[model samples]
Target: MTANANRLEVAGHSVLLTFGPGLETVAEEIDALWYHLRAADDDGATPQIRLDYALPSGDLPAGAVPLPARPEASYTISGHLTREVIRRLIGTRLLLHAGAVAHPELGILVLVGASGAGKSTASSMLGRGGAYLTDELTIITPGTFALTPYPKPVSKHDPELGAKRDLALGGLGLRPAHEAAAPAPAMVLLLERIRDEDEPEEGSSVTRVPLSEALTRIVPQTSSLWALPGGLATLAELLNSVGGALEVRYREAAELEELLRRLPPAEHAETAEIEPRPGDVVTWEDTAPAPGRIAAVPFRQALAMESGLFLLGEHGAIHLPGLAGLVWDLLADAGPLTFDQLEQLVVEEIGEHPESTALVRGTVSDLVAHGWARRG
Candidate 1:
């Protein structure tokens, strides 16, 4: 919106950064933010997110700032804006926090782990074999999990590389997978780096993992699983077709190179075609439950346990625990019940109270209003 601004298009979303007069001192960081998207046009109406950054008269935000200061300031402000833009584009795609690499023919291998688990480091070591998909964010379409490369600069950390250097793709001898030839992900590895004392006495190893465990470990890698329409269902189908996943435990980054080379190429499964459903349809209200039984929506099914319920639907997989899980289980199992029936169920389980009836009815009303449950 301002005259002094820079704009870029990312994942079909436009971002505009408006700079204050004195803030130009950190132009390098600002420019780096738009590394891949810089060539994009800056049409005024095209911007979906607009950010304003300023620098006071005291000092510039360049090298004048503390060692980690410049990286923090620029990375935080610009990175936040970019991450927000991508999160909003989750309707048709998925974002996993991982480092991905192609294996010439084994398709894509996504390395997932918690923060400081050595994803970036492992990717750099494995870069020599094939294309470097990403060292941070892995963007892909559902069902197939065919990785669409999001090749932002790699954030590298190693004793020899100096402290926190953001290296280019070539610096690590890696290149992004070409879109025309991008490969569907063959397998996903849940990475865990071990300390000297914790390293496996037999050395590093890779073992086959079950579908349920793979899904569990991968959930934390997803930043917008709940936002991706039908995301939970899509992931289940994708993992099943991958022949499940492998859990890799390692004591060194380079040790993975040989193991990655020996892994077999995955058999690409046909992407399941699920007819799209209306995610926002509503047929219930806050009024008291009617005489008819309530049922989980056809497109929405939930798995419940003692602690919580895992629902897979157009909305997403939601974990409802305690009261939420209790009510969900009642409605989910008993079909649909009248207000009186639901009230009795809640009281029988958690003990009776003066407001128990009202609370249970209110909970049912909310679930109906939210498209989670409906009268049969």
Candidate 2:
């Protein structure tokens, strides 16, 4: 490695970052932002990725990747580095677009949500009292549920520049990963930031989200979840071990610490086996199916809950609620059924309704539209 090169140990992968001459200022900023990931000594760990940043007009190395010549080049480089590392971790870890913080006795509690859902804020706040694992992405080993700490610098929105600035944890008065104790997988919290207009009088509270609904909410927050081997089945197992998922709807990040601490540790339970099946390709388009068209569900896996069931397809998992669940069960065993036949079955199940025709037709169409059911 050259003097301008720095090695980052990110998510168990070694990344070597090299910069061309005349980019010293940007290189210094990158070094400071990723100071937590700096390797102590090169242990000869083969570099998984080597990032070469240079001005577009500057002389380039044989296979060096160039960084955009802009004020926000560091931010862009940070995002690119994260994506490349996550790409390499596709099938190995169950990567959630979340933040993680330790709970002293309860181990690690992951804040699972999409971007702008306040994961970084919650992690920054909650981690003040405990260890901070990460504030962007949470990496967990499937089955065993072990966490790989990737406490990358927290990105703070800079109003002056109208862009985010990656600030070191020490600067923010939060404990860095190196200073923290080892993390153990424990709980999963789905964050739902309640807007003031949505009736703040109701107040903030934490409630248990249904396992089926939780899966639906969580599936979208994952990074390339389908690439993972067990997919939904593995995720279902992890959720069960964590005593399902809890939804925390709060107006402020400060309220979470005391409220979450009051909650008891989840009693891990044995999860039900999710059956994986061979899936069939189904094209999704606006074209509605004919009334006589036969619809069949070719599922990758199926997880049944008390209220609903989750059908995992090649693309993503679809939550089948009430009649939809029954219809999937019917199609899974009864084989292919025409659209008209399905409506009749739904009518028979509910003892007929004026809107049964539209309801059943819409349900089947949705199934096919989401690639959950194939039209034959």
Candidate 3:
């Protein structure tokens, strides 16, 4: 550690930021953003990650990672630090690009969406009343539903500065996670912003969504899905425990207060493994297959939801929605069945169709081509 070193506790990991010569200004900017997490310099324990900014000799310091060169070195270092932390913890936790706030009684409500979807804005505004867990990344411990806060400064794009500025949470008058009540995973909300200039009277609303539809949208927002073993199954179980996911359509963050406050506490159901029932029917109205034996690719694993299924194959995780999901469940459960037998099962589930012959053939062909199933 050097005289210019500043240590920060980031998501339970210790990171030491050692400033290089002529980087005093960059250090100040970083200090402003993470001052809350700064560790006392007297501690002598080595940090898990030690990064150096703008080394004058253009070479990295011994045992330290050199940050990428950028005009805004402060921002570059912040991004690098966040990525490094995520890289180390990817397989151990489920990381979503969502914002989180904790209610005293209702527990934690996670606001999930893609970038520019106003999750950060919503979290920031809601945090004024609830405990702020995070505004950028929401880290969930699988099965337990415990949250690990990565409360980095909220980055807002500044038109005058021509770059995004990281604003400290304290400066905005919001409560940080440590200062708030202990919270547990309670609800997951899919944020959809409805912008209609002509419909000025429109207000925000929250509605319950089916498991399959929520899985389709929420899976892509996760950064650790591919790395975590049985990730889809874990997520499916979590959704079930919290009484499935909800969709919240809103025009602005300010309008959500009354709606959120009036919402009932999440119903905690018995933890159940996500598997298809014997008599489950998929009414997605898609056709089935004919003739030869069909079996799923070897070593493939899958988890079924209400109307969708996730297949983890040699390629990656695949979302089989609607009719496609039904077909997958059949193959995974009782594969190597004759196409006629498969067709019989499909008929039993959704009844036989006049055009099922060709359509089933097409669906089977697609599965074989995509490495999900093969002719036996």
Best model number under TM-score: 2
What local lDDT score does residue 311 receive in model 2, on the 0 to 100 scale? Answer: 73
lDDT tens readout by residue for model 2, 46-124: 7888787776654666666776556677777878788987988887888888899886665688999876788888889
What TM-score should be assigned to candidate 3? Answer: 0.79
Residue-level lDDT tens digits of model 3 in 189-229? 88988778856777778777666667778877887575676
Off by over 4 Å in 1: 1-9, 30-36, 40-45, 56-69, 157-165, 177-181, 200-202, 264-331, 335-376
- Whichever of 1 and 3 has more lDDT, that candidate is 3
Better candidate by lDDT, 2 or 3: 2
**Model 2 lDDT-worst window of ten:** 280-289
TM-scores for every candidate against the unseen true structure: 0.65, 0.85, 0.79
Clashes of each: 3, 0, 1
Q: Please identify model 3 stretches exceeding 4 Å from their true place.
A: 1-3, 55-72, 104-106, 179-181, 197-202, 264-301, 312-318, 333-352, 365-376
TM-score for candidate 1, residues paired by index? 0.65
What are the RMSDs of all candidates, in order? 8.5, 3.7, 6.0
